[model samples]
Target: MTAVIEVQNLTKRYKDKHALDNVSLSIEGNAIYGLLGRNGAGKTTLMSILTAQNFESAGTVKVFGEHPYENSHVLSRICFVRESQKYPDDATPRHAFKAASLFFKNWDQEFAEQLINDFQLPMKQTIKKLSRGQLSAVGVIIGLASRAEITFFDEPYLGLDAVARQIFYDRLLDDYAEFPRTIILSSHLIDEVSNLIEHVIVIDNGEILMNEDTDAVRDRAVTVVGDKAKVDAWVADREVLHREALGRVVSVTVLGALSDDERAEVTASGLDLAPVSLQQLIVRLTQKAGAETSSDNQEVR
Candidate 1:
């Protein structure tokens, strides 16, 4: 897989706060990537820099082996669907699609029309008068139908209901199958998009917390449920991410993969081992990172 986006020691500072802190990572082409983190975690900042919408305070960023700023060639191949995408006060969905068609060389007018119909969007209504869900539909339609070589969706479907969001996800996957491209999706609905993403990149406190294959991330933790005494003995030397207890029964989530023999032993000991979902794993990892950061700050003081 070729790298379509690259960053080296990237840093974006705003006054006294760092939006991005010495972040370094490469995004491969022709795959779906989840750019995930809590609010203020630099997900949007990183995407802004990559799409040339904002400047990085320090370090380097490259898209398609060249700087993205003022580079029409690089910019043309990228589509950025912001969460609060704006349009002219008088512009309607029709005008919005028209402008997008002219900008994105790979834009599919037929596909755009189909999406409009799917969402039942009113074409002539001014964008300002449109409902929140309708406004979001416009962005989703543009993002999907543009078909740019590399697309970034920064929570553009937040206003849509569950069913509508599902439609966007389905259409995205369908189009991507026929025309493969690099898609970086930054969203708070981690569990919703977990299966859709091929890779995961997690940021926390302006730093990269986790970057790896989604499958590998899933294997990073496991939960065991059994008697308190048995669970405590089994997890005594392991790193525990989360734990819960109810009347003598204990459930402990630990970091590390158990070998086949160990898994067998666990079952033989009457403990139930459960696989961790991507969302669960990411939440635990971020919480752990936050706890450690607080501890370190206290030590520094």
Candidate 2:
């Protein structure tokens, strides 16, 4: 299948920093992709470039088989919901939805109305007067309702509480199931959206660290928590991602999965086997290249 998005030798630089290095990636269409990274890790820069909201210092970008810049057809097929989406001072959610409907080719008026009611967004209230969560609801509504071929959501649910966040997730998944489109989400809420994302793209310190299936990334590490000595003995020969300790009980996040014999040995040694946290592993991977996980764990190179 043709890639929905492609970046070749991409680099974005500021006066004194490289927000994105020589990154190259291809995104297959019609799948939910998690663009994982911390703030200042180039997630926004990459998205903005893809959506033509920002100019790239160098390299090439193609969306839907063509460069997106100044291309109305490509631009109209993409929707980017930013954390700080701008609006007219006196405009309401109704106005915003109206504008979106005019712009997006596949705008679903009925779907937009359904989302507005589900989110309880005030149609008459000015967007400037809405609460943070309400504002986020407005963005989420447009994102879901627009039904663009390639949608990029850059932390669009900032101030929403757990319940509201779940609503967004559920509605997004439901809509995606019926009408599949490429959805790229950049969020710090890793585990929460883990289940929603089938593909994972990790960026760290201005470079692509990992881009693979979520299941494959999860299989890259395992966490073992138990007696310190046993944990250390088991992990000493493996690369350690992170470690934490509470008195004598130590939890070590190792870089690879245990073999059958290793798992048996862990159980035999009274060491508890546990799932590794994707967040912790990503956090460690994003740290300075040579930096290890602190004194709690030994970094076995």
Candidate achieving the largest TM-score: 1
- Candidate 2 local Cα displacement, residue 136, angstroms: 0.8
Regions of model 2 farther than 4 Å from truth? 288-301
Local distance difference test values of all predictions, in order: 0.94, 0.89
Question: RMSD (Cα, Å) of candidate 1?
Answer: 0.9
Instruction: Count steric clashes of candidate 2.
Output: 0
In model 1, the runs with Cα more than 4 Å from the true position are none
Clash number for every model? 0, 0
Q: After superposition, how far is residue 140 of candidate 1 from its true place, in Å?
A: 0.7
Using Cα atoms with residue i matched to residue i, what is each candidate's TM-score against the true structure?
0.98, 0.93
Q: Write the per-residue lDDT of candidate 1 for residues 1-301, one digit (tens) a residue.
A: 8999999999999999999999999999999999999998999999999999999999999999999999999999999998688888999999999999999999999999999999989998999999999999999999999999999999989999999999999999999999999999998789999989999999998999989988888788999999999999999999999999999999999999899999999999999999988888888989999999999999999
Please give, for residues 168-234, the per-residue lDDT of candidate 2 as tens digits.
9999999999999999999989989999999999987678988999988887788889988878888
Superposition error at 247 for model 2 (Å): 4.3
